[model samples]
Target: MKNKNVFNYLKQLHADNAEYKEQMAELKKLPHEYQVVYKEIQNFLWEFTSGDGMDMLQPMYGLLDFFKEGAGNQVPVLDLVGEDVGEFAETMLHEIQAKTRINELKRKMNERVKKEINQNK
Candidate 1:
C-alpha cells in the first residue's frame, strides 16, 4: 500500500512537471513584446538565484502583474507567471519580516543582559 501511494505521488509530480514545461514552451512562443518580458523575467531569475539582491523583487513583481492583467484570462501563461512572481515576492517579504523580528528579539535580549551586568557591578 505504501509503495502504491508513493508511486501515485511520483506520477502526479511528473505529470505536473510536464504540464509546467509545456506551459513555459507556449509562453516562449508569445509575440515580441510578450517574449521580451519573458526574457527579462528569465534574466531576473538567473540574477536572483545567483544572489544578486532582493531590490529587484518589487519591480519585477510589478512588471509581472502588469503583463498578466494586460493579458487577462485569455493568457494562462501570463497568469501563471504573474502568480509565480507574486509568490516569490511574498516569500521574500516573509523572510525579511522574520529576520527583522529575530533582530528585535536579539536586541531586547542583549539590552536585558547588559542591564543585569550593570546592576551586578
Candidate 2:
C-alpha cells in the first residue's frame, strides 16, 4: 500500500511537472524585460513559501498570466507592475496567502463533513 501511494504520488508529480515547464517556456518567449521582472517576482515570493511550498506556484502562474496579457497588449513591463515591482509582488503574496488560508478552512470543513458521512454509513 505504501509503495502504491508513493507510485501514485510520483506519477502525479511527473504529470504536473510538465505544465510547470510549459509555463516556464511561455515565460521564456516573453519579452526580455518581462522575463527579468517575472524572475525577480518569483524569487521574492519564493522566500515566503509555506510548508511544502506548493502555494507559491499559484501566484507565479497568476503572475505569468498577467505578464502574458500585458505583453499581448504591448504594455511596458513597468506599466504592468508599476515602478515598484517589489510592492506588486508583496500584493500578490498577500492575496495568495489569504487564499491559502481560506482553502485550508474549506478543506477542513469538507473533511469534517466527509468524516460525518463515513461514520453515519
Candidate 3:
C-alpha cells in the first residue's frame, strides 16, 4: 500500500480480521529474533486485554520508546561488530549533531525574517 509507515501498515492489518490472522500465522515462519518481537507484542496485547486497561500500556510504550531512541541497535551492534561499529555510531552522532545545529540556524533565521517583516509592516 503505497509506502505507508509501520503504524499505518499495522492499522491496515488490524482492520482486516482475516488478513491479520493470516499474517499472524505467517509470523511463525519468521526468524527467531523477529518472532521474539511479535511474541512480546502478543503478550502485551494479552495483558492489555486482561488487566484493568490502565498501566498495561506502559510496557508497550516503553518498547516503542526504546526503538525510538535507537537503544536497541546501539549496544547489540557494538557487541557484535566491536570497534568498527563504534566508529559508525560516532559518525551517526556527529550527523545528528550537525542536523540539530542546522535546524536551529534555520529556525533563528526564519524568526529574524518574520520579526523584520513585522517591524516593516
Assess each prediction's global lDDT (C-alpha) against the native: 0.56, 0.85, 0.47
lDDT of 2 at 58: 67
Q: Please report the TM-score between candidate 1 and the true structure.
A: 0.35
lDDT per residue as tens, model 1, 80-116: 4555754644554444343333455677899999999
User: What value of lDDT does candidate 3 attain over all alpha carbons?
Assistant: 0.47
> Which is the winner by lDDT between candidate 2 and candidate 3?
2
Clash count (model 1, backbone only): 0
Cα RMSD to the true fold for all candidates: 10.1, 7.0, 13.6
lDDT, candidate 1, at 50: 21
What is the lDDT, from 0 to 100, of the residue 5 in candidate 3?
Answer: 83
Candidate 3 at residue 18, lDDT? 65
The true-versus-predicted C-alpha distance at residue 59 of model 3, in Å, is 14
lDDT of 2 by residue, 1-121 (tens): 9999999999978877887899999999999999999999988877776455567776788889999999999999999899999999888877776445446667889999999999999
Tens digit of per-residue lDDT, candidate 3, span 4-54: 687787775565656445555655544454445535554534432332332
What lDDT is reached at residue 7 by model 1? 100
Q: In model 3, how large is the Cα lDDT of residue 58?
A: 39
